[model samples]
Target: MNQSAAFSPLHRLWHSRRFRGLVPPALLLVLWWLATTHEWVSPLVLVPFGQLYDAALDPQVFHSLAEGIASTFGRLLQGYGIGIGIGLALGVGMGLSKAFDRIMGPSFHAVRQVAILAWIPLLTAWFGTGDLCKIVFVAIAAAKPVVMGAFEGVRSTPAQLLEVGRVLGFSRLKMLRWVILPSSAPAIVTALQLSLIYSWFAAIGAEYVIGVMSGGIGSVVMGAQEHFRTDVVLLGVTLIAATGVAMNKGLRGLPDYLFRWRTRA
Candidate 1:
């Protein structure tokens, strides 16, 4: 191949979505290194990238991080699972029945209007600094987006489709199964993705607020902060960011696989 031809594909690949997406973070990392190396910021405030990298590799730091991740993940799963169940049920109920909507919609909206973090004080007071409080907080954070997404999905179902189901002599249950659910599959998947993102943030925030004694990434960060271990804190932040990105990417794959027909259409 000619030199131009050989380079052309590489050039195009560099501009592709995945490669483009990496540029900003790469630049930020470069900037961070510059800032630390040149003392643009004090080493105490922003540890050198080299120090952070070294801390991450330390056996003691690695073990603590592994344990923290496992503990946080367990709580996140518990809370997020509960939230999804409750949100799906409420969303479906409100979407399907005017009476149910009238009864529950106002209350749901009212509760949702309050920020999830605002509940932390009350939860802390009620449940103490225990895992229960953190779990409940994560659940609340996860449920709101899910409930709204599911409700919107069901409500947006085409009337013609429902009529077709009726014409085919589908009972309410059958109509729900064949028409409502299939139609709402996209929204449900979107909700789950959003919920997953929210739950991670919530879980971390909850752990931070509850303190290191509670145990998790948040606790690790907080503990590091207490001792002014900026390297460890930055490391925790980096780990959280990387994990969130990986999780989002993983979840994004599911909808693509499940609804590949949409792309073909």
Candidate 2:
């Protein structure tokens, strides 16, 4: 057999979709190394890659990182779950009934216009800068995207499909179960992904605000900044970005698996 005819497993692996996605990050890492090595920016402003890696791996720092991640993840789940539930309920109701849409649409849009951060002060006052306030802030951040996604999904469901359901004499429940829900699955999935991302960001932001008393990755980063531990701050940022990417990939897998047919078509 010709040498070229024999496929190289390593070559194939390198060109694989997952591996290809790492190219940009790898390039960025190289750029970061260059910038730091040449003193494009002072070490104080941008810690060298070596120091950042060392700080990230340090046992003491690792312990704090682990604790902060665990706390933040727990709060993310709590807030995200609550927000998703409420968004789904409202979206479904508004989508299904014209009267409901008319009654709630204006108020919903109006409220959504308010910035997520704006609610933080009121929430802090109401909940007293504890886990509850942070959770509520995260929930608010997650809910807006979810509700919008759900609403758009439901509204965009084809009228022909509904007509088909009607022609088949399907009851409202049956129509919703078989027709509406399936049609809206994609939108809901997208919304879920958005909500998850928003929740993570909100959780971090809330932690940064309340984390001095409470504790999370945000708090760790803030404390590091106060103490002039730039390496630790960079480590926290890296962790947050990596976690966000991991979460998006994980959540995306579900929809991709469930909706494989859409891609096949």
- TM-scores of the candidates are 0.90, 0.84
Instruction: Tell me the lDDT of model 1 at 235.
Output: 84
Q: Highest lDDT: which candidate?
A: 1
What number of clashing residue pairs does each candidate have, in the order they appear? 0, 0
TM-score, cand. 1 vs. native:
0.90
lDDT per residue, candidate 1, 138-196, as tens digits? 89988998899889999999999999999999999999999999999899999999999
lDDT of each: 0.91, 0.89
RMSD list, candidates in order: 2.4, 3.7
Residue range 1-265, candidate 2, lDDT tens digits:
5665566777797889988998998998899899999899887788887798799779999999889999999999999999999999888889888899999999999999998888877887799998998888888888888888888888899999999999999999999899999999999989989899989999998988765668899888898999999999988888999998898879878888989999999
